[model samples]
Target: MDLFNSAQGKNISFVRPAYFIIGGFIGMAHVKFYFVFLFFVYVVSVLGNTIVMLVIYLDHNLRTPKYIAVFNLAFVDLFGNSALVPKILDTFLFNHHSISYNDCLTYMFFCYTCLSMQALNLVALAYDRLVAILFPLHYMVKVTHRFMLTMICSFWAFIIIAVLIAVGLITRLSFCKSVLINSYFCDHGQVYRLACNDYFPNDMVSYMYPVFIFWLPLAFILISYLYICGTLAKVATVQEGLKAFKTCIGHLSLVAIYFIPLLIVFTLMEKIHPNARIINLSLTSIFPPMLNPIIYVLQTQEIKESVKRLLKMDRKLQLKRIAIM
Candidate 1:
């Protein structure tokens, strides 16, 4: 927080965020508003995910394997946003692609790597559903708490490997010729465009790895969920099906909202649709952090009731403390 508040850091952040708030994402008018918005997201996302963790930790009934998986998902989103959003905000709000070479490399690699953790998280969640529905008894033993820890560790380690591979490839090349980057932030794909030396390996890793690692996992998860959906269709009891449907709906909504805009924005970047960039960025960066908490509140009965009761209890406690004073 102190870093962001520093006069220098604050100055650097001002140049990056115009892609969304003022609707000139490509025009590069004011990155300051964008960083302000990102700071807001960081606080809210951290708090929102923490609330989910607290609600689950406080409530014994929420200790089921399913909600446990949800806790992991929340954790992933929290850290993922933390890693990427703030740095991007700084690039604009601070400098016009003015990041120190080392800082840019570190920031870009780690941010994307952290975001890749989400790929594995969703896959893990999908498998959780598959086992729960098709083989409940086995799901318990297979998706045990220890097993969850292993998944988390392995996923992060692999993410590091991917980052190293991409960055190692890029840093080996030269970029002294044309330092000015066109993108609002320094995505390596856009960075490659500006590099003066050969970037064939960088290009290959950039082009292929996102597909092999992130997209492949996402596709598998979608396929698994499709089968899960079909199985859900066969539930003999309407009440049982509705219960399952409600739980999954919140996550599915998040996936759609996150993925669609990303596909359109990144895919169409070369085509140069400023409106799409603005819309896509707002949906991708802003909504998920702020609105996802609302998703959990509406979807999970335990959380909704807990929040309501928490609010009531807090009010009473305040009033009683006031009377005594």
Candidate 2:
């Protein structure tokens, strides 16, 4: 393969490989058991998220701005898990480790886009809570259906474009060296680092992507909650403050579930074993999708009631059908 790309007029060569070997749980002890657990998680995630979305769709009471963010979160979770877990099973469990270069980039695009949106969706939920508690009187006006939809759509658009740019940068890289990806999937960092040519652009993106996806969204959520706390403190009674805080329990649980594991894993990356790091990263990615809907269903009264109402309506419909028959 040619080492230099004379077409660039910079003596840089592009040696793109046909396929990259994914080092997913290879040589790991009892890894199949983990994959089985991941399969169970994926199945529950699909069912739970689908049910959440269905409830929000069917229940007119849930057709509010708040549920818009809820619905979006469920969708993002479902999409994110679908993009990740299935591919992991196929690649590692089935021993189909060699993925085409373009396919790898495509995989990274979907996984990262959904992951980014998951964090931003939490930000949307936090914004909803912030407006609800801090400006209760004007909550409806501030968090209208149109406004919520626009916010979620804008997030989707921005994340899609940002992830696309990241994937595009990988095309410029020449992976003349080892094409073995150390992580589970076609991780952007692991893939780009294998490039024989300069990957400065990819490296810059690696740092910036986390800030946008993790740090900024987390900072926004924290600041919003701080403002919420300040507002609640001014309320006339302790009970009133507690009630307002109660509304945030579901969102808080979600925020913690989604962000805490990621923060811990990244902070402790250097000290952890590579296999352990990969497992933690994989868990952090898959667990949130499975847990998000469960948290909302259990911690959020509104969703719980919606689910109950949906079940009752379905039961009534079935009884009426039997009566007619």
Candidate 3:
């Protein structure tokens, strides 16, 4: 790592943490397979999420404040998947295992920042649905465009500050030697473990910070769901209850895919094999982005109809251009 120049103009070389070793199971064949599989994942995820965001943008009917939260969630998935999967493809397919210290930090910052933002977006989505169903009369007043914009802005600002603080603490530590990070990407947990100084404070901040940052939003989502469920149970008809449940299915599936494997890895982090841990991380990171739009298209009739209508219009426009030519 290049820290600074001395008064004597000597380029002082710091003990720069060099290449991080990304864990993979088995031989060269596995690398090729991973490359193909993950490339497909990245392409499909980006395309799907882009379509979701575009439909929400183009359609006047879907311009409610709740869809604003939904659009932000799509943006989060696009951002996170873009940050992570291409690097994995490079690492596996081209044997580019080495990531610079600066690149690693950039990767970690975006990954965590997006993850934090996604959690908050889900929390907002849950609250939106809760308001719509539980108190339909006040839903418009409670979840206004102004309110959604404020929440989205606040979430991004908070994650930026939190990541900057953590990275600031990381920069203060002295690394005595080139350290090998045990994962594919420069995860804060993987990188911070390489510091030579007193790691107690870093560990404390790392472990304690997430409970409030991640779990608090998660808890709010859970409470919102609980109230939604309880309120549905009291509805006069089973069809009404089912209709209410249908509204939440997309968000519920997204939360399940995003968090369940992550919870499993968190529970078994210390005990799992390095390859297993890497696999879990990759799946949890990549799967949600890939599945999110699919979930909405499948579960939400409005989005499905909107997508079909858009595609039909696109086909018609293409034919008209062909006729003119």
Candidate 4:
């Protein structure tokens, strides 16, 4: 309390709390089952994303510019889930609801950063598909490994800075009122609204952050697909156009998985029950990481064949070792 009271400004003194209570899952019936499901989702997400990354790393055939985005997506998904799910379980399931002020901000930073990257990563994949489908002749020259790495790295740098700014704005707030954040995690909007001081900056960020992370990325992806469609229309035959478009199915599935639930929940947020909304939001956060690898492995022939070849090699080694025994 003494430490927080020392933060004095021109005229106004700030009242910062030592900790905030997370009551997102409190007083909800059958919440334990949701935690169990989350555990299952986390386990599968870890295994699936790990496999995808390992396959991409071990198979030289999978090291194309396209797979670079895929590899990064897997890494982001793994890191995102690792950042969110465990803390959620510990907070709600194990009854560790009180989060220190600094820890809550750190939690918010990682969760928001990873969540923002998920959207921007889709933009990277969309760019890869756009160039590959629209400009096949120049795809090699345009979408080199170095170019893809640069794009992904640029996204990382931009999003880290942006999220840091958002988190930084939260520090300017003075939570003199109730420190109970009503969300599942340390949500940005929930945390700032509890402040007694001027939170107009935080409120502005609440509006702008969604535009950068959600709307802009979705717009880019839609426009890219429109361009892809326009190009495919001039193909020699219907089958050729279909064949070209088939390559985008995995990416399309990913976009749908990532965006659709959030869209629905946000669109109907006022009408939905608070607990239901929280559950839906939690699902939106956790499901994509679990589903992304499955979609890619099943939809992309390259990844499927890589998995097959690796499995066959492993089986052969086992057979040889058994024969030796």
Candidate 5:
């Protein structure tokens, strides 16, 4: 009460309690084990994405179009995880579940922005591969560094505008209920459901924006693959066709890993309990970033060889150290 009053005196438009209690799997069984599992996922997501960025930075051969998209995806994942996972850890480990109304909005904005950027990055990746497999001879000319830079800049601009619009709309709605957000992080859906004013516009944007941001990119990816498959079918030899198709194997795996859980979770959202919903949401959010680097590391021969070479150098350095000692 004191905190809320003081904040109100200072012109802060906060909920009476001044914080929203995040329903981060409250009353779930074996919560410690859940914390341990989520902690491991957080570590893997951060470390794996870091390694992806570092590997792409250190290897000159990976400075091309496809790896550039991969690098951008890793970067977005790292930022998104940084924004979301720490709050989750705090909630589970330290019982700090109260988030201020303003902070909640900020977090939601960043999460959506990263999500939008990731979808755009996937589209860029699909286009990159489409050009490579469909027009191998002109891939370099068509997908130049300058072109990629322009695309990246344009994407950031578009997402910033979109996020600002959504946030602006959300901030206008009034909330007078108990400030309890029924999710791990501040989901926009959960937050806006507490609004006391007209919320139909917010609902419309919430549901419709996803179609443009998520489904459109998905459609583009499918079309790109269709063209890629057609082109591969026309290749001279079976081995050549296989080689071309193999290049997309990692991407296909990544897309499946990222999207399938989300689809299932969305489909079953109403059927599941709140705790189950939080667990499902948290897993679907974190797992893709954690496994993305692993998929690339395992599936791409170039990255595997790079890792092996790095290991060999470490071994040679160890031998030199022993000799010196």
Candidate 6:
């Protein structure tokens, strides 16, 4: 990959940023087989997200605003993973590391933007649940189709604008320094660190998205869920309280799964150790897409059970109609 330096008459690389690849001077196969491990993880992710989307899309029981929100989450995860994982696999497996300026820009833009939007979606979903539970009488009106659509549009618009500004600054940068990315793919921090010019503006704009995308949403979600829990407590029925608590557990588990790794990955990138960087980064990008669906289904027994019941009903009706005919 240093050939780019000679061909373009510029230098870029950080003294073989593969410290974490084969174990970072540590004898762990986790670093040695990172590519194979990631391949299995990505396959499960694609299948899991695809199954959620397909089940939700084809099943009438899943057409509600709740699962539509989930469908959106799954779609975002699928696309974001698709954008990065394939390229990553290519790099690690086939030794195809060179990327065009435009390809790099597109990859970075979508992956980063989708992550922002996904976190926002979860935050919004938390609010949706609060509205559905605490103010049951007004759930339909509050989470109406038109309002959901508007929120979706607004969220995308705001996030895309933020990402565009960051990415635009990146494109204007002269990469007169190292081209080697210390991570698996084109991460914003790694790229921003490579620019040879004034990186103050870049730093100000670079990766500041986590504050907006993660911390803000995380705070909102935590508060909303707390409210949800408090309100659920006041209800008179034990069965009802238990049921609601079960649902909350599912959402909380998922919230932890999504946010914990995210915070860890961004924070750990500060370390000069490549092993910490690779492990954290890989889990942040890979695990959420793979595990989010399982959490959604397992946590909310009603949704998956509803899907199953609806399928059974359809099969019975079809058989009955055929017999009558």
Cα lDDT listed for each candidate: 0.66, 0.91, 0.80, 0.93, 0.81, 0.74
lDDT string for model 2 (95-179, tens) is: 9999887899999999999988999999999999998887889998899999999999999999999999999999888877788
Off by over 4 Å in 2: 1-12
Q: What tens-digit string does per-residue lDDT give for candidate 6 at 201-268?
A: 78887547667888889999988978877887777487887776676676677688889877766666
Backbone collision count in every prediction?
13, 3, 0, 0, 0, 5
Q: Could you tell which candidate, 1 or 6, scores higher by lDDT?
A: 6
Clashes of 1: 13
Worst 10 residues of 5 by lDDT: 1-10
lDDT by residue (tens digit), candidate 3, 1-325:
4432122335643344444455453343455776688889989999999999999998888898988998999999999999988888777667777776667777888888887777888888888899999998998899999999898898889889988777667766656654566676777876778776677777987987779676787788889899988998886378998987889999899888877787789888899977878777878888888899889878898888888888898999999999999
Residue 288 lDDT, candidate 5, scale 0-100: 80
Every model's TM-score: 0.77, 0.95, 0.89, 0.96, 0.90, 0.84
lDDT of 5 at 14: 45
**Candidate 1 residue 220 C-alpha distance from true site, Å:** 1.5
Judged by TM-score relative to the true structure, which candidate is superior, 1 or 6?
6
RMSD of 4: 1.9
What is candidate 4's lDDT per residue for 1-325, written digit by digit as tens? 4324435576777777788999999999999999999999999999999999999999999989999999999999999999999999999999999988899999999999998999999999999999999889999999999999999999999999999999999988887668889899999988999988888989998999889999999999999999999988876478998998999999999999999998899799999999998899999999999999999999999999999999999999999999999
| Candidate 3 lDDT for residue 309 | 85
Residue pairs with backbone overlap in model 5: none
Clashing pairs in 2: 4-13, 5-12, 5-13
Deviation of model 3 at 300, angstroms? 1.0
